[model samples]
Target chain A: MKTEMAAIEIRNLTYKYQNAEAPVLQNLNLTIEKGEFALVSGPSGCGKTTLCRCLNGLIPHFYGGELEGEIFVDGLNVRETPPAKLASHVGLIFQNPENQLFSFNVERDVAFGLENLGVPPEEIRRRVDWSLELVGISDLKDRAPWELSGGQQQKAAIACVLAMQPSIIVFDEPTSFLDPLTARGIFDVIAKLRRKLDLTVVVVEHRLEALAAHASRLILMDHGKIILNGEPRKILAEAAERLSLKVGIPSVILLHRRLSKLGILEGLTPLTTSEMAAQLRGVLNRD
Target chain B: MIRLEDVGYVYPGGVEALRGVSLTIGERSSLAIMGRSGAGKTTLIKHLNGLLKPTSGRVTVDGVDTRKATVAKLSRKVGIVFQNPDHQLFAETVEDEVAFPLKNFGFPQDEIKARTEWVLELFNLTRYRKHSPLTLSGGEKKRVAMASIVSWKPKYLVLDEPTLGQDRENKLRLRELFEEFMEEGRTIIMVTHDVEFAAECGFDVALLVDGKVSALGSAREILSNVELLKKASLAAPQMAELFLELEGVEAQPVFTVEEAERLILSRLMSGSGRP
Candidate 1:
């Protein structure tokens, strides 16, 4: 049997929006293998969102932009396939939840994408229920979308995309509008769902502290190109050394770097606060 | 000074947003209101101006009851940059959006033009000054919304989640701007959930839980107490947590990297020499 192909592939991709002076995405190349959780981050206006839009055929089709490159999502050429056709394979969650949610109630909103794709009623119901529970928002099924808080509405948006049962999901700054606790809860939900579904996940976020530990790979974009892409720990360590990436290194990593420079602590860099604390505890008691 | 005396707000849908909350925000002070979403942080700030009057109690801004003042009249002293830029941005161009507030506040043509240019440049929006506000990205629109309000130079600046969607560079810029604004003896009342930002700014924090002011103290006191933060459904800053989790490391309240460094250095001298 042939091994499963990469979940997403892009080669020398460059896209320019309508009436734009320069290309937002310039000669970008990325490949996300199956079931890989990748986190993409960069400074504001670094073409992160534009790259996400390209994953599901929104570049040349919906936005009417100049596109030159090849993109394959689950072996289907994104340039050839329309967004509607790619919906089942690749789900895109917008940065703002308000942009995606339109239905009156949460349950109906979760069911919207499935119903549009002509999925059977019973199947839609099953998938909607599964997704709502997966995102830990089953209690919000009856509430109106407008009544839910920013965090809840974002959960609902995730459920809407999850209900489609896509093999890959791209979340664009899903927690930008949320509080720290709520943002952590959102990341937890994403990790849980990715593990449960074995889906490839790509999250574009600024809260690297919360996401760096969960991501299998981290990709940093700047001025419309991927400047760094590799293991999250390695990339984050490198980015911390450079300091100019300004990708918002987690506080723990910065602390680790400071101690290492002082010749106080050494070894693997800690990604989370707890990890750093654990390492410090070992060294402090080593006397 | 802004004062809320047992303020209670019941929404039109009969949802009680705020309940018997009493607080005072003095002039030239920086106050950060933090709570989980839907905990009435926004509702409490809405009472600062006359945007939402308390249903059961009174709110006074600088000795004048909000109930007795019109929103337009109160707006001269208090300007709010709402959380969602889409709600406040209505002008065609970015420059016009920043100028609209100054114009509405009755600034002269030359003053409005000068102030608008100043804020636009301060926010680094000169390149997009002619572009429509709607055409900008989320972070850019947020800056425009903020620039529009700050252009008026209100005595009290109210920011709702000012750091949301901002990257590191912009967040640093905002911290600098807030420092400059507070140095001029103006007050800033910000409702945010960014613990790191709050700790960095050294703002006095008020923890709101279910529309009630549960705790009020300095950012050092409030943010370092993991128990208090947990009660409000928030986590203490990681720096604080690191010190807490490490055993036998008695230190003062640590929230930022610099403080943590100092504490660790003192401990390192006692425990072991530097490698």
Candidate 2:
């Protein structure tokens, strides 16, 4: 298999917030390929969001953490790069849309990042239109962020980040506040963008079922360390029990495992609801 | 009991949150309110406890109209737990946080202490009774918020997005607590988007869409209807959806996992295998 080039490279990265007892991230090493859709999931406060901030140059540059080792995003060392400079190559979307959106209107919100980058008015308008269209929130251009739904506001935040024309985008639990249908819709948009734009996407989310089918790879974090990194199916199947113990398992996977334990489900490990249904039907038919 | 007759709420900023909607929730029955954002689930919930008054129409709780009742009076019977724990928690310690509501209700110090101790023990937070609320974890904060409300022993409990930040273990524990509350005949009206949790809790389902009650029925009836769920911007629980797809089983939607298992088992035993 051909190896895709790395868009993000972390070498023995470690970081500790000032006045903390221990480091949040310790000796973490990872390499994310360009245009790959990766899901970073773990228990809350396990340093997943901290990792994201580190990737977008918010750690040493903006947060003033005790940083060690190196993080290079698109060949630029994050330690040396300022957040404003890194904003052009890697866009960061926070978990709370309210924190990211400060503009009076949706269009202005999307254009905020571009304006900071000193993009011309014509190009900024073009980029804002393109980004809004990508997130399916073009019609909400004139509305206040507070007036929009939680899902719409989140999409607008993503569009705001996308307007900067970043090659990589990192989302911190973008759907934590949304309903399941809306969450799925947001994931669909993310998948579409990943396919159409060749953008590297790293999302830290707990809704594994929504993203499991679309993510190119799944990275499981625990105690601020990446424990399992591989294709979704392989990682889920191999680390079933440990995964359940570390972080909550999705309902379908839990059901599949229970059935398997009872000798009612056999063949082909199922990681999703559809796959589980198919395998379950086959078992009943054989009986 | 809580009743809404042609209720509507237009925010001061001119946003129509809840349209003219009518519904009644009987005492001791749990109801799950499901909807997408901007569907007015929150707005409808707020009306139950008199947090927000209807712009048109009436909202009554326990024979008292919300518009005519003080928030304090309604709060004694109706307790609401917001999504963010920080919003409700203001006390320096967990014990005080749980007792704050009781003190506001004018309970004696001895009675408040007793209730606080009971709730702290009930939620297994006794070890952290003296700990600062700000130092607690997200799940801990949630427990404190729940403990505060449950300590009051309100007749009706309304929880908004109870499982938003909870882990699987915590979620399961919450289900157990809700079941206990139901067994004791306390009314629980939860506003949530978690289909699996909703299904497992065995509550009657209410689908709120565009500030209206789009669909209202038993969990089995509402969740099995895929078309209605789609229109409400909701998804059927994975197990419920899977059971519906089975050949011999005529998609009788069930809320709880145990119910789904029992239905599937009965169909299989009757020689009606997968269709």
Off by over 4 Å in 1: A1-5, B248-251, B272-275
Report, for every candidate in turn, its global Cα lDDT versus the true structure.
0.86, 0.81
Residue B38 in candidate 2 has what lDDT? 77
Lowest-scoring 10 consecutive residues by lDDT in candidate 1 chain B? B244-253
Instruction: Give me the displacement of residue B119 in model 2, in angstroms.
Output: 6.6
What is the docking quality class of candidate 2? acceptable
- The CA root-mean-square deviation of candidate 2, after full C-alpha superposition on the true structure, stands at 3.9
Tens digits of lDDT, candidate 2, A12-75 = 9988875456787999999999989999887655678789889988788767859999888877
For model 2, the DockQ equals 0.39
lDDT of 1 by residue, B1-275 (tens): 99999999998867788999999999899999998877889888888889998999889999999999999999999999987788888988898888887877789999998998888887878878877786566777889999998898899999998887678888888888888888999999999888988999999999998889999999998997777887777777888877777743344578888888887787767875222
Q: Which of the numbered candidates is closest to the native, going by highest lDDT?
A: 1
Best by DockQ: 1
Model 2 ranges off by over 4 Å: A1-5, A60-62, A262-264, B84-153, B183-185, B254-271
- Model 1: clashing residue pairs? none
Model 1 clash tally? 0
